[model samples]
Target chain A: MDLIVIIDYGMGNLRSVEKALEKASRQVMVSHNQGDVRAADAIVLPGVGAFGDAMVRLKRLGLDAAIKEEVTAGKPFLGICLGLALLFEESDEHGVHEGLGLLPGRVELLPTNLKIPHIGWNRVSVQKESRLFDGVPNGSFFYFVHSYAVVPKIDSDVLCRTEYGCEFASGVERDNIAAVQFHPEKSSSLGLRMLENFVS
Target chain B: MLSKRIIPCLDVRNGRVVKGIRFLDIRDAGDPVEMASAYDHEGADELVFLDITASHERRQTVVELARRCAEELFIPFTIGGGMRDESDIRKVLKAGADKIAINSAALENPGVIGRCSKRFGAQCIVVAIDAKLVQAEPEKKWEAFVHGGRIATGCDAVQWAIEAAGRGAGEILLTSMDTDGTKQGYDIDLTRAVTTAVNVPVIASGGAGNLDHLVEVVKKANADAVLAASIFHYGTYSIAQAKEHMAAAGIPMRLTK
Candidate 1:
C-alpha cells in the first residue's frame, strides 16, 4: 500500500485531508515526525491559517527541512489551500513571510473588488495536461476559500486557473509536486478523483 | 465568475438526521452520513449540518458524525449549533468540518467571531444570524434572535451582519424566523437588507418551497448562496434540479453531470 504522510504542524484541518485520502483508496497518516515524512511514498501539506503562522509552526517542528528534502528527492507532494501558498517563495498575507521556496511564486491577496475570502465553488480551467487531473474534467468546479493567491513567476507552472474578479492560478504542477488553491477534500467527487490520481 | 451556491442543510439530533429525507437509493433516511453522501452525489454546492441536539454529549456525537460525513462526502460542509468558544470551534474543525457556524454564542459575545476568525482564518468562521421582522409603527425592521429564535437580541439584523463582517467573519448565514417553516418564500427584503450591508457572502436561509423561491433569493436578494432544509430533506427537489433552475434563470451555477 502506498503510504501518504500528511504533514501536521498544528495548523488547519488535517483530519479532512486524511479522510479524503483514505476515501481515495490510499493509506494515509498525519505526522509531524521527520522520519514518518521521509518514509512516506507521497507527502501532503494541508494548511488553513496565516502563512506566517504556518511557516513558524513548520519551522518550530523542524518539518520544513524534512518537506524540502522529501520534495527535492522527487517524491510526490501535494499542497492544499494555504499549503499551496506556502510552497511559493514568499507571502504577504499579514506581513512579508518567507515560504518553502519549492516553486517560483509569491502569495498576495486577491483583488479588492473580489470577495476578500473568495469563499465558494468556482470552475477551474485546465491550463495543461498533467497527471494531477488525469480523469477530472476541464471545467470541473472546485471549492475555494482563501484571501491570498500564489502568482507564479513562471506561467507554465500553472496547471489550472479559476476566475473570481481576476483570473488566478488555482492549481499548479511542477514535476512531482502538485498543489491547488481550492480544497479538493471539500470539492466533491471530481476532487476525490484528483486525489486518487495523485496517489496512483 | 463566482457561481451562486445551493446548500442542503441537515439538522442532526442525537447523531442522526432528524428530518427524514426521502430519496430513492437511501436505505436509512435518518443517517446523516448517508444523507450527506446522497447530497454530495447529487452535486450539492455545499452542505450545512446544524446540530439541533446541542447537549454536551450530543456535541461529541455531532463531531463523530462530522468525521463520518467528511470521510464520505467531498463537498464543503459547515457545522453549526452548540459552538460555545474557540475551543469548540477548534474541536469541530479538527473533526473534519470545513467551517463552524456560531449563533447564540456570537450574540452573547460578539468578540468570538473576531477571535475565531483571527485564529482560524475568516473562512472557517461563519456567523449564523436568525432574524425576525419587528412590527414597528412606521417601518418594520428585522431584529436578531438567539437560542433557536426563542430570545430576541434586539440587535438590528442589518447592523449585526455588517458588524460580523467587519469583525472578520468570512460568511454570514442569515435565516428569517418568520419565513422559516412557512415555505412562503424567503424574505427578500430581509435578505437584501443584510446582503447589501455586508461584504462577506450571505447565505439566505428559510422559507424555500420551490425552485422559484431559490431563484428569488439569489437573484432578487443578491444572496451569494441559498440554504434550504425541508425542501431538500423531503426530496421535493434534488440539488441538481435546483441548480438547473438557477442556471436557467441566468444565475451562474456549477452544474454537475
Candidate 2:
C-alpha cells in the first residue's frame, strides 16, 4: 500500500484533504511528526493560517527540514491553500516571513478590485500540462477562499492561472512538488477528480 | 471568467429538510441526501445545509444527514448551526461536511474563527452572519443577529464581516432577517455593503423569489452566489431553470447543453 502522509502541523484543513485522498484510494495518516512524513510514499502539506504562525508550528515539529528532504528525494508532494503560500520564497501577509523556497515565488495579497478573499468558485485555466489535471476539463471551476496568492518567480513552474481582479497563478508544479492556491478538497466533483489524478 | 454558482440551501431541523418563511415550517422537505443528489443532477453548482436543529439531539441528526449527503452527493456542501467548539466543527466535518458555518459561536468567541481556520483551513471555516436592519434616527444600520435570527447582538454587520475575514473566515453566509421569507428580493444594500466590505465570497441568503432576484443580487449586490430555499423546495424553480435565467441576464453561469 502506498501510504500518503498528511502533515498536520496544527494548521491547514487536514480532514478534508485526508478524506479526498482516502477517496482517491491512497492509505493516509495525519501526523505532526517529522519521522512519519519522511517515511511516507507521498506527503501532503495542508495549511490554512497566517504564514508566521504556520512557520512557527512547522519549525516546532522540525518538519520544515524533513519536508524539504522529502521533496529532494522526489516524492509526490502537494500543498493546498496556506501550504501553497508557505512553499514560496516569502510572504507579505502580517510581515515578511521566509517560505520553503521549494518553488521560486513570493506570496502576496490578491488585488483589491476583485474582493479580498476571492471566495467561492473560480475558473482555473491550465498553463502547463501535468498529471494533476489528467481528466479534468478545461475551465473547471474550483473552490477558492484565500486572501493571499503565490506568484512564482519561474513562470514555467506555473501549472494553472485564475483571474480575479487580475490573473494569478492558481497552481504550480516543479518536479514532484505541486501546489494549488484553491482547496481541491472543497471543490466538489471537480476537486475530487483532481485529487484522484494526483494519486494515480 | 468564472461561472456564476447556483446553490440550494436546506434548512435542516431534527435531521430533515424544513421550510420556513423565517423558519415557520416544521414539516420535512425530504431526505437531505436525496434532495442534494437531485440538485447535483439538476446542475446545482454547490449546496449548503443549515442545521436549524437547536438541541443536541437534533445536532447529531444533522451530522448524520451530512454523512449521508456527503457520501452520495458529489458536490461540495457546507454545514451550519450550533457549532460551538473545534471539536464540534471536527465532528461535523468528519461526518462529511466540507465546511463548517459558525454564527452564534463566532460572535461569542472571535477566536473560534481563527482557531478553526488555522486547524481546518480557511476554506472549511464559513462565518454565517444573520443581519437585521435597525431603524436609525437618521439612517438605518445593519445589526448582527444570532439564535437563528431571533436576537440582535448590536454589532455592525459590515464591521463583523470585515473582522470575520481578518480572522480567516473563508466565506460569509449573510442572511437578511427582515427580508428572509418575504421573497421581495435580497436586501441589495445589505448584500452590497458586506460584499464591498470583505474579501471573502458573500452568499446572499433570505429573499429570492424569482430569477430576477438572483440576477439583481449577483449583479448589483456583487454576491458570488445566491441561495434560495422556498422556491426550490416548493418546486417553483429548478436548478437548470434558475441558471438559465441567470445566464440570460448576463450573469456568468455554467450551462449544460
Candidate 3:
C-alpha cells in the first residue's frame, strides 16, 4: 500500500502531521475511519491537547481498538505527543483515563521543578536500534510541548531518552509500534529526517 | 533540553509582509510564502503571520498565503490579526494554519477564546495580549491596549492574562507595545507579570533587538519562547546565531545534531 493514513479523531493536529509526512515523500491521507487506516501501508496518530480529551475522542470514534489491531497486523505505527502518551495504560492529566494499553506504561504529569508543559525543542539520544529512527542522526532534537510523559514499566520499552530537569523517554518502540513524546513534524530538519526514516 | 524557539512574526498588510518602527514604517518585506519557506529552511522553530490588513483583502490573501506555506513548511505556523469570528478562524485552520491567534476580537467577545478552544482543540488556539504600560492610574496598575494599540482598554494586563487562561486558552502571546521596536529589551516586568499569572506557555514578543534581550526575557521573565521581526528580517542575526548566544549563556537550549 502506498498510502500512509493519519488517524484523526478531531483532537490531534492533523494538518501539520499530514504536511510533515508528505514532506517525507509518503502519500498521506488523514482519516478517522478504521477501514481506511487498515488499508494503508503505515499509520500515524498525532495528538495535542489533554490526554483525557484525546482518549474520549478516540473511544467516541472507536479508533482505540482499531489502532491496536492495526499495530497487531505488523504495519508500522507511530504516535506523537499525546498520541504517544495515550498508548500507555492510563493518564492523570485531568483525571484518571484509560489508554490504548498497546505498551506497558502509565502517563503522568512531568515533575513540577522543570516547569509544567515542557514547551520547545528538545534533543533525543537513542537508547537502542529501531526502524523508527533508522537514519536519524544521534542527538537530534525534536520539538516537544506537553504536560505529561509515559513512564515505561519495562526498560526495554524505551527506545530513546532526553533530559529536561530530569531524564525521560523521548522516543519508545516495541515491535511494530513506536511513539515519540516530541513533534517531529514541528522539529525542523532533524525531525523531517526522522519522518523520512519512518516512511522509508 | 528544550531548544530555544526562533519565531519570525510577519505583519501582513494588504497581502504583503511588512515591518515598521512602533507600527509606523509599514514597508513591504516580500511574499509571505517565500519568506516563510526561507524561515522554515533557515531553522525557525515556528512562524507567526499577523494579518495587519484592514479589509476583506485579508480573507483572500491570508488563506492563499497559508495554503502556499503549508505546502512547503513542515513546522507549526500560527496566523493572527483581523480574525473576528469563528468562521474567520475556521477558514484559516482549514487552509492549513496550525494555530489561530486572536487579540482584538477576543477582547471584544470574551467567549471567543472558550468557543475557539472548544471547537478546535486549545492547542490550536493562541490568545495574544498587547499591553502598554500606562503612566499610572490612581490604582497604580498598568492598563492594556486594544484596537491595534490605538485605544486604552483600562483593564489590567495581568488580570486579562489570567482570565484568558481560565477561558481555556492553550498559550499566551504577550507583546509589550510600550517596548516594541525600541530594541532596548523586553519589558521584564510585563513579561514576568503575565507569565507568573498564567500557567500556559508565554511567548515574549516586541522589542528584541539583540541576543542578550532574548536571553534576559527567558531568564528573568521565565518566558517559554521569544519572538522578533526587524533583527531577523534585516539579517542582523540568524536563528542559529541567536540560539548559539542563548546556549553559550547557559539558557539550556536543545543542541543541534
Candidate 4:
C-alpha cells in the first residue's frame, strides 16, 4: 500500500485528483505540508491556474525546494496542467517568470490563431513511450483547458504531443518525473486508466 | 482534432434534479449525483447541473452537489446557477466542480467576469448567456435575457458574448431563448454569430429536440459543444445515439465505441 500525496499548493480543484486517485484504490491525501511530501511513497503535483501565481505559492509554501528534492530523489512525480508547465525553466505567461527548472525548455502561449484557452477534448499523439499514458491509445482524446503550451528544449523529454494550432508538448517525462498539460482526472475512463498506472 | 462536446444540462431546484425525468434503470432520478453518474456511463461527454434554486440559503446545496459529483463522477461536470460573487464561484470550484457557469450575476455586473477569471483561471469560469431574438430587421439582433429569459437586458447578445470573452470568460454557454423550448433546432444565426464572434469556445444550448437537431447545431452552426435538457432527460435519445449521429454528420465527437 503506497501513500500518494497530491500537493495542495492552494490552486484549482484538487478533490478531483484526490478522488480519481482514491478511485484507483490507493491511499491518497491532499497536503501542502513538506513533511507529507517526504512521508509519501509518491507525490502528485496537480494544479490549474496562472504560471506566475502557482510558482509564487509553491515557493511561499517552501514546497518548491521540497518538490525539487523529491523529484531529484527519483520519486514517482506526476504534474498536471500548471504542474506540467511549472516543470519548465521559464514561462512567457503574464511575464517572463522562472519555473522549477526540473525539465528543459520554456512555456509559450498557444498560437493566437486558434482559441486562446484551447478548451476542449483534443487528441494526444504519444511521441515517446512512457508510463504516464500506459493503456491510453496512441491518438486518444483527452480534455484540455489552458492558454499556454510547453516547449521542451530536448526532444527525449517529450512524452506526448497534441495539435491545436500547432504541435506542442502535451506531456513530458524524464526518469521518475512525468507530467501532462491535460486533466486526466476529468478526462473520463482512459484518464482514470492513466492515473491507475501511476499508482501501480 | 478536438471533439465537439455533448453536454446534458440538468435543471436542479433545492439540490434535487427538477423537471420531468423518466429514466428507466436509474433508482433515484431526482438525485443529481445518480443522474450524473448514469449520464457518464451512457457516454455523455460532460454534465451541467444548473441550480435553479431561487433561495439564497439553498444555494449551499449546489456546493454539496459539486462535492458529491466530484466523489462519484469520473468525467468533467459544470455547476451553474445563482453564483453571484467571487466567493460563491470559489466555493463551487473548490468543492471540485470542473467549471462554474455564471448567468444573471455576470450580466448584472459584467466586471465580475474579469475579477473571477483573474482569481480562478479563465478555464474554470464560464459565462452563460440566455439570448432571445427581439429584433429581426435588416440585420438580425438578439438581446441578452436574464431571470430564466423573463427579462431582457437591452444588451446585444453577440456583443455581450464578445465582451464576456474579452473579460476572460473561458467559455460562453449561449442558450437561445427563441428556439429553447420550440424543439425545432438551435438558433443557427444566433449560435453562429456568438461562436464566430468569441475567441473562446462557445457551447450552444437551447432547442435540442431530436438527433438531427443535435447534428444541425454542430454541423451548420459550428458550436464547439451542444447542451440539451429535454432531449436527454426524457430518454428521447441516449448520449451514444446523439454522439454517433453528430459524428456521422461529419462532426468530430468523443466517440469511444
- Full-model lDDT for every candidate: 0.88, 0.83, 0.81, 0.88
TM-score, every prediction: 0.95, 0.80, 0.87, 0.95
lDDT of 3 by residue, B50-100 (tens): 887765666677777677767778778998877788888888888888888
DockQ of all predictions against the true structure, Cα-based = 0.75, 0.27, 0.53, 0.75
Each model's total of backbone clashes:
0, 6, 2, 0
Write candidate 1's Cα lDDT for B55-88 as tens digits: 6675677678767876777788899878788888
Please tell me which model should have the higher TM-score, number 1 or number 2: 1
Candidate 2: tens digits of C-alpha lDDT, residues B1-257? 66778789888777766763221232333567667766776778889988777666756776787777766665678988777888888888878777889899999899989998877778778899999998756766799998877788989999999999999998889999989999999999899999988877889999998889999999999998888888887878878889898888988787643
Better of 1 and 3 by TM-score: 1
The TM-score of predicted model 2 comes to 0.80
Give me candidate 3's TM-score against the actual structure.
0.87
What candidate 4 gets wrong by more than 4 Å, as runs, is: none
True contacts kept of each: 0.85, 0.34, 0.68, 0.81
How many residue-pair clashes does candidate 2 contain? 6
Against the correct fold, how does model 1 do in TM-score? 0.95
Candidate 3 lDDT: 0.81
Error of 1 at B53 (Å): 2.2
Instruction: Place model 3 in a CAPRI quality band.
Output: medium
By DockQ, rank the candidates, best first: 1, 4, 3, 2
